[model samples]
Target: MNLTSVDELFETDASREDKQREKVLDIPLSKISDFPNHPFKVKADEAMLEMADSVKQYGILVPGLVRTKADGGYEMVAGHRRKKASEIAGKESMPCIVRELNDDEAIVAMVDSNLQRESILPSEKALAYKMKLEAMKRQAGRPSKEDNYSQLGNNFSTKTSSDELAVQTGESKNQIFRYIRLTELIPPILEMVDEKQIAFNPAVEISYLTENEQTELLETMKQEENTPSLSQAQRLKKFSQEGRLSTDVIYSILTEEKPNQKEKFNIRRDRIDQYFPKNYNEKQKEDLIVQLLESWYKKRQREQER
Candidate 1:
């Protein structure tokens, strides 16, 4: 009978559970590097502090996933947050599940794991989707459309990668494409989208502008203290495509008052209270005022007709 070592037996058992053949290994924190272009942020916020406390009290309950690098170090595949927390907890080494994965496979796994987080920024999703889409296309051995997007013209029909991405991510095909469109936006504009300062539809339209045009638009927005409406953004995109967009043109479009952009009127509560009942609430006072205005307008119209 052949005697198997305990480590070997554990490895054999772990391999049987997964087709990928993952093995838990204690890796030094210094040897593990971050995944290139990892879209998810690892902030040392309250949650991270809590996780660090947990790690200090009980060690890392879950093992991180990592792959061997060409230079002999390990690249983190998942659990970046866990790694950071472990470092904070004064841990020299962390338990990791080692796996061999190619670039496309790693990208897919990394994206899938991070997407499960509760909160993801818009810019993070945009860049992550773009990376995964490119990886998927590469894996399929299909040439990317980005290299000759303008040369292929607007009538091209290559959405296989996007469709696959949509299926994987639970987003609509059109929405996936829209998020990918955000990759063309400059960082400042993209950050605005993440901050909710810019709406999604308008941001998509703005992404079509050339870099110079986008810079000018950013300046115009800052000067005017306003963001583009969907219609205005579309007009800017159309003008850019036509090669007629300029700083002056952007200024003109931005200066145009939108139909819904009405000036607000404010009234002091103390000033209006004398005109209403002492017991009347704010809503009652507003309704009574509106009724009186309607009656006054009707009386004036009747007099004018007489």
Candidate 2:
């Protein structure tokens, strides 16, 4: 019942077919317990109210989905608002389509339902993609090109049973791969991707970047207008390969494909350090401390501003 626990969300009990067809007739809302949404889509109050008005006027166009309760009540799946609106309208019994989905099925169903609205969070998409991939792996023992993922109990992978998930989803292999890459990005940038502040291709390009590089580009991205470019990605690769890339270079590559950036730090170990103790804090300690403090200050500043 808490959105913070992904484990709990994915571990819910599924619905059974016989239970789905058990014919729980016009169950009164009062009799059926209210199920609060952990990950709710209730933000658009005007919209929910509008939908409620529609439900009140013409009745629930799409039957609310529910699951059978052991105590002779029902738990909601989809259409929480419709159930709520119907109850608000003082209806004794509300129409519903009862289904019993397992934990995984429930997660998939909840994700799919949320996807119907304006936009789904990138974090949600990442989890959904991961769920499907795991489910596909379970079904076929691997991501084989032959099996139809759709036929499986849960098609969590981007593609159906067949390896043609790209075709089925109407996305390019690159795009699909890019979406999967979003899974690798840490939360903040992923949130940025969900906000539509960052475009898909550029974000994917950034995902391939290393943590340091990603952190670097993310800092630059805040000050700059658009996200990094393909050219920027390539440049980053080149710099990283050249073994001289810095946070500045990361920003430069992302913002301008220009090689105006230079490595910010260079460590030159003295030829005599071999005789010192491995655990010793030598004369270099003071300088190293200053550098560490500078980095910490910058990080703290970013955190505060954020």
Candidate 3:
């Protein structure tokens, strides 16, 4: 990983002092404003509330980045969520760290900061990974014929650059590919994956399903009234291979609205036991045996259905 593309990698030839000055700093949030052109932040109502709650207790732990505005003020380069949360917390101003980031550095720094936090969600992580790849792309430009988005799938985007980036970053090509696959997952499904309700491999497999098919599966999960289980996913895959799996069929699998339990009691005592050896009567034994037989019959029927 010769990330040290020499000149390309550094963007500037500077000493330790310059690097130290470029490190994240804490400035008043009031000094920073939104980037009208920034594309990394997703507008998530739930996420906004989550961020607000985090700020209310801990305060802004990681300072935001800002570039000097043309209007003689600071405009946010990253940490929009933090900035928004500061407003929600009723703070008169928030802390910021100032910097001059060329487009690639700003994008990478923004993502790098968020990625360091312990509590980012799966969707957010997906976006973070995408941002990194794109930023790296911008810095390195596109690869040669290897840049096909299809054959490489998540393994490489704009194929021209993944191997080089992986070498530079010391991240494996496989991991990069997996992170990329996560982007294909729809929002609700991604939420499930984030929440740990869905395992990764199955989630990846589910992601392979068309977007419409994934939507259908989500609806089925609601109706079937059960969380999507590992077994159910395998069954869905089987049907998909058979070409009979549809949103409707998946819904039926989920709802599985059939009778749950029907039990019966039984006995296999010797015929001589009917005598009860004393006061037990013929009618009592006869009734007990009949009940036992009915229970056994029902059990057999249930077994046959399975």
Candidate 4:
């Protein structure tokens, strides 16, 4: 006859209890704290307002995840937006599944859950990737009994935590590194990247500038009303590394027309203003000219295709 060992029976009982404790519970919003240094922004934009209305009518379809804090109350691992929606709906609590997770584990879970969102801004991705990568490195440092394996579940074949993250997130290691570099950018300049006023490649290149240099560049951009092109950003970075990126140098570079601008049709505003209505402002006239040129270019392209 086969007999179950005492340790086996005890382990089974513990596992069953753990599963039972995993059920959803109504956690008071007041008792739940946001995750430490949560990188994702919780905006009350149209999507969130719509979610609140749905929640007010139908209630949350999915529960959030949280874990007990050492001091008191629970810390959110995921579902910050749902919590916000619940608040907007005038609810006292939201449903959440409490879990047992250490700091590193929670960081990984929080980042993974938020990364699944349909729309994430570049600054959001930048901070999230940086946080997750750092957490992965910390987890990797813990000694493992298995050969060449980390607590993060990465095989040493991947070489580093960044490489492991690249494999999981489907971003090249270099690309991941570039995103991480964005965390170093000053807030105003970083916001420009998020707003798409500064293109991604140029923004990443600008991230290398010293904080003071970046601040100077921001002032220069405002004065010139022009952002850097990739070529100009490269030149700035080169000068920065050589310790010669002065405020005057920044102005000199920014005031210079970009390479793309060099090929643009040039006409004095007054020369074209006579073709527009007398009341039309400079901006209106310039915009009309651009629209007309775009239409002409598209028509030419279609003719060439034919």
Instruction: Find the candidate with the highest TM-score and give its number.
Output: 4
Pitting candidate 1 against candidate 3, the one with the higher lDDT is 1
Model 3 stretches with alpha carbons more than 4 Å out: 1-62, 68-75, 81-85, 143-160, 164-171, 227-244, 248-306
Task: Evaluate residue 140 in candidate 2 and report its C-alpha lDDT on the 0 to 100 scale.
Answer: 54
Model 3 lDDT per residue over 1-306, tens place: 645667556565566457667655555666776665453454548878898888888888877777777667777877787788878877766667778777678767767766665676666665666666777777876543343323244443344566765675566666566666677878888888888877776676566667778888877665433555556666776787687888678877765533452343334346457546566675786787678889999999999999
The digit string of per-residue lDDT tens for model 1 on 113-205 reads 989889999888888888888898899888887422221123336657666676788986667778878889999999999999999989999
> In model 4, where do residues sit more than 4 Å from their true spots?
1-21, 142-158, 262-306
lDDT of 4 by residue, 1-306 (tens): 999889767787768787667789998999999999999999999999999999999998999999999999999999999999999999999999999999999999999999999999999999998788878878989333322211123335537777778889998776777887788889999999999999998888898899999999999886556899988998999999999999999999887866557544446555665689989875787789889999999999999999
Candidate 2 lDDT over 107-220, as tens digits, reads: 456545655666556655555555554554455556443332221223345544324544545655444555666776766788888888777666665665677767777777
- Scanning candidate 3 in windows of ten residues, the lowest lDDT window is 143-152
Our model 4 lands, by Cα RMSD against the true structure, at: 9.6
- Please give the lDDT score for candidate 2: 0.61
TM-score of candidate 3 to 2 decimals:
0.56
RMSD of each: 10.8, 16.5, 16.2, 9.6
Stretches of candidate 1 off by over 4 Å are 1-21, 146-159, 264-306
Clashing pairs in 1: none
